[model samples]
Each structure stands twice: as C-alpha cells, then as structure tokens.
Target chain A: MDEFSFINSIKQHSYKQSSLIKGIGDDAAVIRQPTQDIVCAVDTLVEGVHFSRQTMEPWHIGYRALAANVSDLAAMGASPAFYLVSIVIPKTWSSGEINQIYVGMKQLATKFRMDLIGGDTVSGQELSVSITVIGYVERNKARYRSLAKEGDKVFVTGTLGDSQAGFHILTNPGYYTDEVYYKERHQQPLPRVDFASKTENISRIVFNDISDGIANEANEIAEASKVSLILYEKQLPIKDSYEQFPPKLQHKWKLFGGEDFELLGTVSNKDWNELQIIAKETNTPLKEIGYVDDSQSNIGQVFLHENKQTYRLQKKGYTHLK
Target chain B: MDEFSFINSIKQHSYKQSSLIKGIGDDAAVIRQPTQDIVCAVDTLVEGVHFSRQTMEPWHIGYRALAANVSDLAAMGASPAFYLVSIVIPKTWSSGEINQIYVGMKQLATKFRMDLIGGDTVSGQELSVSITVIGYVERNKARYRSLAKEGDKVFVTGTLGDSQAGFHILTNPGYYTDEVYYKERHQQPLPRVDFASKTENISRIVFNDISDGIANEANEIAEASKVSLILYEKQLPIKDSYEQFPPKLQHKWKLFGGEDFELLGTVSNKDWNELQIIAKETNTPLKEIGYVDDSQSNIGQVFLHENKQTYRLQKKGYTHLK
Candidate 1:
C-alpha cells in the first residue's frame, strides 16, 4: 500500500492507554504520564547484523526488536508504558510480512501493557527496525548500576547461555539436529519486566540485563559502583542441555555470549531474604551466584572463581573463550 | 573502538539536564518532564531513500534526521526537551564520520536546549539513523491537525520549496553552479519550534509542518478536520530566486517537492491580529495563505485558486502537478 495508507492503518490499530492523550496519526503522540519519572531506551536491529531474513521470520524479528528495548526497561526497574517503532522495509518484502511484524510487536506490547504511541515507516534497500520504549518508575526508585554496594549478592533470573546455544544450533543445524529448545530460546527470548517489579521493594540493589552477557554487565556494575565483582562459575544456573556442549563452549556462551535478555543484579545481603520472598511470590527462578567486594577501591574488576581457581574476567572475551 | 568504549565515551560526553536523572551509561535514561503532557515523535532517514553519503555531508545527514523529528514536536506546539539516537554504521564509514554525525546532532540540540539522553550503536550493511524526540506541551495547549475551524485563516511560517530546489541543484550540480542559498536551505533547514509556541495562546488553531510540502500538509489538516481549504496561488510564499524557474516547476516544487520544514496551519480569524502581534514580537515571518471553508463537511478537500480558476488538490498528486 501507499505510505499514507500504511500510517493510517497503524494509527487505527494502536493500543490505547490512559496516559496517552493522543496516539498515532498526529504530528507527535501526546502522553500525560501518571508518574513523575520516566525511563527511555532505544534499540535498533538491522537485518544482517542481528538477524537474517532468510533465517528469522518477520514476526520473530519484530518481537526480538521490541523485546530488546523491553529488556532494557526491565533492567532499569521500570514498568513498560509506551513505545515507538520505526521500520525500514526493502522492496522484496510482502505486505503480509509487514503485518506479521506488527502482530509480533503487538503481542509483546500487549503482554507488557505498553501502548504503541508513534512510528515511522520508510522504504529502503535493506530492512531494519528501531524501537524506543518509555517506562515509568517511582521517584528515586529506578535501579542504577552504580547502586551496587559492598556485601551485596549478585543474582540472576532465568538460565544463561541458552540463547547463544539456540543461536549456534540454528546457524549450524547439521551438527545439532532436532534442537527445538535451543532454536526457540534464540527466537523467543522473554523480557523479565515482571521479575524486575518484584524486586522493587528491596533496597540497595543494582540491575543490568544480560543482553551482552554477564561478563560485560557485571563489569559495568563493578566499574560504576567502585567495587569488585566475584562470580562463582559453578553456581551459574544453566539449562540441562548445557552439559552436552564442550566445557569451553559452555563457559564462553554463559560468560560472554549475548542476547540472553535475563536480569543480572546485585542486592544487599540483608535484602537477599526479601528478594527470595518476592522471587517465590512472583514464581521467578532466582539464583545468587556472586558477591560485591570493595577491597580494591581505586578501580573495579570482575573475577571468575572456578574449582578453587580465580581469574580476572575482562570486559573483552577470555583468552580461552576466543 | 569497541562497542563498550564507544558507549562509555558517549556517556562521558552526554549533555546534562535537570530533568534527566540518568543518561547514556545506564540501561535507560530517566527523565522528569516539566509539563504534564509529553509529545513524542520518531523519524528515520535511510541511506538511499532520504539521503546519500555521496551527496550529503555526514553533518547534514545527522542534522536533517533530528530536524525532521524536532519539526514534528514544533508543529504540536511542544518545547523540545530530549532525544535518543539509534544509528546503524556500515563498514564503509570511518570513526571520524560517525563522530561528525554526533557533532551535527549536538549543534541542533545545544541550540534548542535539548539533551542527548540515550542511543544505540550497531554495525550493519547500510547506514540509517532513527531519532526519537520528546517534548512537553502544557495541558490542553498542544495543537492538532483535526482542530481547524470554518472561519480560520490558514498561515505558514517560512518560504517553501527551497529544499526541493536545493536538492535538485545538488543532484544536477552543473545546472546551478553559483546557487548556495538553495543548497544551504536543503542541508540546514531549521525546525520552527520557537515560531510554533507564539501561536500557543491563540485558541482553536490547527497545525501541520510543511515537511512534505504545503499540499500534503494542508490536505492532512483538511482530512483530519473535515473542512475545505481554499488557497490562492498569488499568496504562495516563494524566494526571490523562485521567479527564475519554469512556471510548472515552480508550482511543483512549492506544492509537492517536500522537506520544507516549515509550519502550516489555520487559526481562528479573530486571533489573526494577536498572531500578528506574536509575529512582530518573535520577529517571525508569518503569512496568510488560505481560508478554511466548512461547505464540504462530511469529507474534506483542498482547492487552489489560480488565474480565477479553482482546482482540487489531491493527496496523491495534482494532474497539473505531474
């Protein structure tokens, strides 16, 4: 269809929210936020960079793009409220494929209660999607990486390395035939927005989602908070299928692989019981695998402990990893 | 540089604002808006569709991308507050070019008192930039395209078609050897945010930015407000150089050439004097171009009166325009 008709169709299908005074179809979407503080994060996924059209369905691409933005909000301890999508379509795509992309975004947006407020559509040589998510948190309640304190325990929600494993399986199907679980994990990784809310009551906490793996996330917190992070390798929660992979591959995927979309955070020692209670209440799988140390205060570092041996985990991949 | 270092560098150089509680380093940027109503607009400019690296400088590409989004907020009578940039970088570009892009965006942001809150960086095959801008409009003060009144006087802020002419001159450089005004107009079109606020106090006004030329913009108001818009060809604003073009070319450029980045609106006839006062106070170039007629109520249409003959302006394109 024409650009005007495409925009009009999007406007008609927009989900309404109480805060959204005006949705699509205007020069800009108007929203009267209920809370004073709002958090915004944007993510752009290109066709060849993040996903290939040949391997990924249009629906999955849409879901994954918005999911990445949602995961950022979840990492900041915010509730999803509104979002905008800008998509560039190539001439090769069919209109039906475009519809499926929106359907995918709609499903995730509906689940998170985020209204699709505005978007831009353009014709280009390659496909790309950029989504910006706006969310709300109470005044002074939004979590930050610099909030991680000494004696705080590092915890994570959900299993790690599964997404990378799934991606690897998809890329090398001949080697790992019949690995539906891995493929699904790569395509349909869930954002932990609900889990983030459950931990709101606990104080002295810091969160960073595992979009770029724990090595990077933990280091970010360590550097920002001026503390060292000591993670126990054996304590990491991995899927049952993780044992089938080589030892190095498992460590590489769990520690440095990207796109897990799970929350990795540190909380005060006293708040650990409180976090556990909320975890039980929310039915979220929570695991404590590390602790914050302030011994080396001038600079921060992340140390990985495995079988009584400890080594510095640089932001870059490990020597063994590459 | 690596992605982590790139993000860290961006975080260090972020513009600080009181409302921005957290900036680029975190998962999301937190903002506490001044006004109750927030207006959001997103625009994406693709490599080949909206611009080309060969024709447009890196600075202008970045400036133009953000300007388009800023204009949307201006049309809604909102003050620009914050923006997030998500850009896809191709292997063909060097780090210096990307730096120039951000420098270009920073120039506009500084001029308008906007903060660079957050952004995403990714590697891709094609270069594209998607910018989402957030602005605040006072409660019930935001202008809408669907608010045109029957006895309203249609107004515009700046001259039109300069951008199209500039683009044409650039593409056909040998034809317009000494023309620099048109080229500057194309590359550095200003967002009329200040001009939009002047009409804020005038009640019952409808606005649409002249990004896609006056024809498309005025038609949007006509369709939204369900009123007939009658324009006189004699009242059309054109540059002194416009007389040099062929009659058909002049009409096409002014009406449908696109990317003018000016404000087009209809205000109550009673408030025309007050708008004139605002025009004098703000030193804005405001002009009365047309009138809104309620004769065509159920569905709206736009008509142009030229040489004592009236012809309807279709949204698609004019027969005479082609």
Candidate 2:
C-alpha cells in the first residue's frame, strides 16, 4: 500500500453525507455550505526538517499535520472542516506504516469531524506531507495578525516552551523524560480551538502559534505590526526541569527552541480581566508574559532585571533551515 | 531571499477579496462559497521523479504542478478556483530561481483566476513542488472513475503519449523535438478542460486524466471499474513524428510513458455522437480508442493485431517508484 492507498482506505470509512458533493478523488474535495463560507489553511511537514524520521512515530507524524493546520484555523477564529492531504514518501517504506499514519490522522479527523476530501500521492526520496484544511467562519468574525495596538498586554496560552522542554526530555534522557507533562507536551500539543471561540473581544488581537517558539513569534508580531514588544525575562514561564538546567542553556532553549503550537496573542490592557474570564470559562490558561511597548526595540530582544543589573536578552530560538 | 521569503512574496501579491476570509500567513487560506461546494486535489513533482531538474525551467516546474492538479479537477469536471503550494529546494539553488517558479504559477493563477493562497517552504536535498488546488462543482455534476460499464466506448481527448514524446524529445533530442506539433505537445500540454466540461451524461461515464500514459490509465480505470479494456491498435491516433520512430518503440512509449494530462473517459455508445458534437463545439477531439469488456475476458492486457498475428501489449507504463 502506497500513501495514496492508505489515504483511500481511511476515506473509504468516512461517514457518507449529502453535503459532500465530491470527496477524496478530485482536484479538491467539494463540501457544500448552504449557509456558510469556507475557511482554509495549508501546512507541510518534512522529514529531517520537521521531524526526525528515526524517532518520530507514524501516528504522531500524522497527528501533528492535522493538529498544526487545524491550529491555524483556530488562530483565525474559525471552525474545523474538511481537509485535503498530499503525501510523498520513500517507495521503500512499508504500506503498513503508512496505514498507521492514516489511522492516527483518522482519529483526529473523526474527533474534529474533518472530512478527508482528496489529495495526491507520489514516491520520493524523503517523506513530505502537506495538508490543506478547509473550515468555516462568519465573514464578520475572522481574525487577523495586524490587530494588536499600543499598550496591549502580550498573552500566551498554557505554559510557554513546554513543548520545547518536552523535546529535550525525549532527546536527552539524562534531563527529564518520565514526567507526564513534558512527554505529553512534546508529543501532543493541543490546539486551542476552544479557547479561541470563547474569547470574542480578543478576535482582533495579533495572533500567532508558538511553532517557532514564543521569542521568535513575539518578534514576528512586533515586526509585522511595526511595534516594539517587551518580554519580562523573570516572568517568563519555564518548566521545572528546564529551570534545573544551567541558566544559559535554560534561557537559550526556552527562548529559541520551538514546536510548541501554543497560541500567542496581544490584547489591550483594558481587556486583561475579560481575557482571564474567557480563559476561565474555557478552562484554558492565558498567561500574561509582558507588554507591547513603543521603545526603539531591536526586534525580539527581551529585557532582564537581576540583582541591581539590567541586561538584554538576545534571541535564542530554533532555526529549522540552519 | 530564501524559499520561505519567495513563497511569502507570492502570497503577498495575492488579491484580497471579501470572499476570501483569510488569505495567507496562517496555516490555510479560508474562502467563502455561499452555496457552492469546493473541489480540491494536490499533485507533487519531484526533482527527478517527476521532471528532470537539470533541463526543466523553474517556471515550467511551477506550471506543471498547477497544471497537473488543475487537470485532476478537470477530470472531476470541477471548476478551477484556488490553490495552495508547498515547495522544498536544495541549499545550492538560488532564491531567484525559486521566485521564477512562483512567477510561472502566478501567470497560470492570473489566467484562471484561481486564488493563490497559502503554502510552506523548507530547504531539502532535492527540489519538490506540491500544489493543492480547490474548485467548485454543482453537487450533481461531479464525475468519478467508477462509472464505466461493459458496453462503454473508451475515448481520450487530444492526442495520447505526447508527453512521453515530449520527454523523449527533450531528453534524447533526436526523437521528435524538430516537429512543431511534437515540440509544443512535449513542452506545453493543453489540458482538456474544455472537452471535460462538455462531457454530458457524465453519470454514465468513467473519468480520469491520462497522466501515466493511456494504457496505464486504462488499466487504472479497468481496475477501479472492475472491467477489462481493449484498445484497437489501428484506432490509436499519433502525430507524424510518432510514426517516424521504430514501430516497437512507438507503441512502447505511447503505452507506458505517462504525464500526458489529457482527458480520457469511457461513455455509452448511445452518447457517442452527442460527445462528438460537444467535442466539435468545443474545438477539441474526443477520439475513440477502445471498448470496455468483461474482466474475465482479457484481464489487464491491451490487444493489437499486426497482419495475421495477435499480440498482447506489455505494461511498460512509467512508475514513479521505479
């Protein structure tokens, strides 16, 4: 079974719906929305670059593709819908492993009610998977990345860099691997869809997923929005195991390492309490990291104050291409 | 500029319409289609597996990705609308070449009005381009590969094996590149979108694109439709250059080499003249190649008779894995 056959077999078990005009074999899967418009996104994951083929599980590989793309829709304040997947795998890979990947993707798709519309398959030297997810959002309520303003408080969901810390645990056993929090955060980063829908007033906030780590993502928002962002170094959230590391390494990994997939947004200071309320209602943590500043900031450098000394925090982020 | 920057530049130039809820920068680009369902498909072209990176221009590489996916949509009789692209390039390649590829895709997208949406870019050892194209089709007009019957006359629009001929011309040069008809067919494939749209009575026809040569595609339709297909050797149309080749080589290239991207369908005999009328109206040729037969009668073989001897055509079709 090639990748195409594996996808087909999973699609074969999809619940038949009249709204799906065409599914799983065309250029695109056509899903009808008599009263709604379609929301969509595309994500690509490559072996060695996105995941180490030697250590990555087929299920996790499949799960992350769906999760990462769906998180994009969530950031846009949209609901999940159908998706098309394109996969290229080495011909030598077994069909059984490919099937397990689909099995993993199907678990998520089923939970999310995502229709596996259509995609293409071909043989290649390395594994590459690209998924285009289509969802729906009210035209009036779609989110944007250029909405944050001056005096906005920077907000991030859940613990920052937990995923990165999880990576370290998985990679170096001498650090911390047996801890449930670290392992789960690394293997399965939850997309904050529930938190997104609950926070309506924050829709206009500059939003990004911490796939590239909070430090880099914060800088992205600052650069794109054309504002200086001040991250409080001491207030920065770090896993307990991460704190046990040498100060230099801890700061480096937490600030620069990515793969967190957590939501980061900036809201006006006035909405801080309201933001907390929404997070409470959704039972999701919305951590306040710092503030959007007007200083002549040099991109993503953080400010630290320690023992009668002030220091600049340089970017210590993950670099995929490097 | 890197691959990401080049792709980002392409996304930046995409037109923003009210119908497009989200354009780029997110995981996916979301669009609203009031009541119409969307058709989507993806196709990936690798450096050597799909095209020779050394000879093929970047623009053609981009064009082929869009064209191939567009061809798939045409097979489903879906209207072309939007597409997302993901590409991986080697470190040694220049960003200028990558931008040129996007320029190629932009030209096609501009011509077709298919919205250029979102994608991902990464550095890799070999170049690979993947495009997911989305379109819309009425619920009732969508076509598939499972509708052919025993009595259906198999037809292919335009000429067959021209891509293989083109490949030969470009690779070997001494073949057919000298002939204008063969040269253009090899370099610029005219997808049968016009012919596909005119395929009325689609409910009674099995549909697919002839990418992997007609013989291989016939086998695919045969396998999907659970029927055997027989091609009349005399009825197979060829250009002048094809005849110049050795007889055995001519048949072999036409039967096994793929990437023609033409519309190949099988229709009931009753709709034959009507199809011809539609073809004439559209100024496209729908040539009759063979007939569908009982699976038990011939298995998966194409039959041809020369003088008094009957011979079975071997499955010499191009395999991506191979």
Clashing residue pairs in candidate 1 are A166-A182
Give a tens-digit lDDT track for model 2, residues B144-193.
66567888998888766677766666677663434656655655565666
Docking quality (DockQ) for each candidate: 0.21, 0.20
TM-score of chain B of 1: 0.86
Root-mean-square deviation per candidate: 10.2, 10.3
Name model 1 segments beyond 4 Å from true.
A1-35, A174-178, A319-322, B1-35, B174-178, B320-322
Candidate 1 per-residue lDDT over residues A74-98, each given as its tens digit? 8877878766778888888876787
Residue A316 of model 1, lDDT score: 66
Model 1 Cα shift for residue A305 (angstroms): 0.7
Off by over 4 Å in 2: A1-34, A175-178, A200-203, A268-274, A293-322, B1-34, B175-180, B198-205, B226-228, B292-322
Query: What TM-score does model 1 score on chain A?
Result: 0.86
lDDT of 1 at A288: 97
Best by TM-score: 1
Give the deviation of candidate 1 from the true structure as CA RMSD: 10.2
